[model samples]
Target: MSRTLINRLSHARRPLLALAIVAAALGTAHAGYNVWTGEYTFTKDELQSAVDKRFPATLRYGELVSVRLSNPRLVLDEAGNRITTRVDAALSNTVIPSPPVNGSLALNSGVRYDATRRAVLLDNPTVQDVEVQGMSQYREQLNAIGAVVAQQLLKDYPLYTFKPEELRFNGKDVEPGAITVAPDGIRVQVNLR
Candidate 1:
């Protein structure tokens, strides 16, 4: 009777062991999905390239006055959580044949994710600085013009966009929470909706 009982206990342990293994496997898979919050990173070159494509933009106040901005350079400000774009600028008066005032315009901007667009956009951009080669008298006016141009060009400008699948994970919809500027790149927080 003792040998028969021992054999029955061994048979019961085998099924229990198999059940435990299956339970652990399922738990591991669930944990893997739960552990993911979502972090999207983009390199400096990628941001720079996005900015470059919009450039050589001309803002005209009238037929006589126009400002052309081109050759943008993007700088990530990790500490400020902002970005800086410096573009070569040429302000010209169609009436004046003397020459175009050549200089560079610098803009500082924060970022936000637009759900409707599924893109990261430049938010609340301001004219950080302006340096013109020969136009010392018109610096103030130039700064104002730069602000308007920057607003039209950079405000809500998409820095990065997400595909339909990129925002969906494990059959769940996720959205961008916050944007962070890093030394190497930009980091976006993702959260479930």
Candidate 2:
């Protein structure tokens, strides 16, 4: 009886040891570790600095022209997420402020920043009308203001690029206008016009 009991105990021990080994192997397989270096660290600041340098202070705004902008829209895609933006009302401006010339200069226009894509987007922007030589030269002044802003942005962010995807003038969709600006914000209309 003693011999038989001892043999049964040894057999149980072998299976228990095998189960422990299998559990350990699975744990290691599921562990979160860098496959190559087995380490992880944050690098957001370093990446942001490099992006800022590449894009610099120029090309913040575009050339100024006496034109009306109505129903602007923007579609952004990041990491498989799509974001749609639009403005409902139209805007007119004469003296758009220059883009940030340097880090010290405050941005005259509001811009939405997408950290994932490293992109900055400007919404409906406007500048007060200015008088030149006693004439209401709103168009020329607007164009000049736009030029200044664009130049500054270009300098600051050289890598920034824009492609026109759609144009919505007075609520009608225009092809090839990528970014749209609406002061009152976008609204959904259910009824067919």
Q: State which candidate has the highest TM-score.
A: 1
Worst 10 residues of 1 by lDDT: 29-38
lDDT values for all models: 0.85, 0.33
lDDT of 2 by residue, 1-193 (tens): 6999999999989998998887666445533212233221113232233334422222323343232222323333333222222222112233665331111111223334333443433433333222233234455644465445433332233122222211122364322212212332211111112
Stretches of candidate 1 off by over 4 Å are 1-37
Which stretches of model 2 miss by more than 4 angstroms?
1-108, 119-122, 137-193
TM-score of 1: 0.79
Q: Each prediction's TM-score against the native?
A: 0.79, 0.19
Instruction: Return the lDDT, model 1, position 191.
Output: 92
| lDDT (10s digit) by residue, model 1, range 1-193 | 6999999999999999998887676445433122334577778988998888898898897677788899999989999999999999888888877578889989999999999999999999999999999788988888888889879999999998888877776699988888889987788887989
Error of 1 at 155 (Å): 0.9
